[model samples]
Target: MGVSPQQHERESFRADLDGNVRAHALRCAPIAEALSGATRASRIYGIRRFFGYFREAAGAGWVLLGDAGHFKDPAGGRGIGDAFHQAERLADAVGDAIGSDVRLDHAVAEFGRWRYRTYAEYYGLAADLGVAGPIAGIVPRVVRGLHARGRIDGVLNLLSHRASVLDVLTPARVLGATGGHLLRAPGRRHATLGELGRLATTEIRRRNAMRKPVFQSGPAPRPVQQETPEPELSR
Candidate 1:
């Protein structure tokens, strides 16, 4: 039996051939050796591109939680832990509303709002970082500075959700990196300044393009209907 071109492209794994493994020999001896001796064939099993979204959080008596409520690129390893945190907050909100004077719907509605506020910035950052390709723009310079200061652990923690993006990419670090690049040799300085201006404009346009419910994960939410009063029977 033969596989279709599309199927082969999507599923077949050709081992025992030159790929990028040779490129790693100097830095990663184990990977180079594995590539040298590997004889097994298996499918590639990692995400090939980015896919993520946000969805309506609550309606009537229904509540969406975890991936059903929202999902972002898993690159940062935040999904499972985030779900657990959400569950805890949700349990508290629902329990209090049930036992107290607050309406259950109101409690859940507020939870939804809180959820967005808490995660939106991180959502944008994750999407930006998870994009496939070399990391670009000012980030590399900023990372270099962090490395020089022995603070790269903060970046690792940011990815693992133990720290915030702002905590690591502070104004001082960003400015310092930009200033350093701007002070490079004249030819390099000109190129660096142009790139910075271009990236800044792109960033501004991106922010302006963003709208509420930034990404819709599923079907559009159904509109709420108001209850109507029944007319009294004629006397």
Candidate 2:
């Protein structure tokens, strides 16, 4: 159900969903009928952009895990895996604190640091995938080109959450792949160069934006207190 906003006009996309369902129904009649019966209760949930991090992730006796700690767009489909990873990490830290002389606060803080270090690249990748922008166009074309050249395993690994974005898309690897493509297909040299150039420019802009601090003209606002029993940890 998820799609790039840039690739689909809102109304047309919604209209096409019925046709798509019907097409699927043609292949599987029974399922189609069931789906049709369920249509009345079905409601559209529009796509949303979500990428956020808390400046701190642990406080007092509590720490956060999964979406409670960090969240990115659903487009990446990394939530479940990320949750499991975070849970395991938090459990390890808590176990260490309970079993040894280490302070719970210090152990939890270390867990938070590890979580950010491990998932920062994935977060960036998820943001890029979820946002409707030039990267949307660039990524598909790059993947297609790499697929044609039988060199798309890295990208596939990244999408499947089997590899970190940084590991898969390192500068040296990018340059090597682009250079190989240029050498192997002389006709596509210009296009390859252009795509790499655009990608580099986009990355630079993104990094610069990340480096720029948000300016607030007034006094800093107080942190909102949560009413829940468990403290809501942010990271």
Could you tell me the lDDT of residue 133 within candidate 1?
61
TM-score of 1: 0.65
Tens digits of per-residue lDDT for model 1, 76-165: 568888888889889988986785434888889888877776676567677767665655557889988888989899888777766776
Alpha-carbon runs more than 4 Å astray in model 2: 1-8, 14-17, 20-41, 48-55, 99-102, 131-156, 183-191, 201-235
lDDT of 2 by residue, 1-235 (tens): 3324444455564555544434545566666566554433343344423335533456667777776666666678888988997888788778857845458878887886777666665767787776665563345645776688897997888887778766667776677767767677889777778888877887787567545433222222332222222211221
TM-score of each: 0.65, 0.62
Total clashing pairs in model 1: 0
lDDT of 2 at 31: 61
Best by lDDT: 1
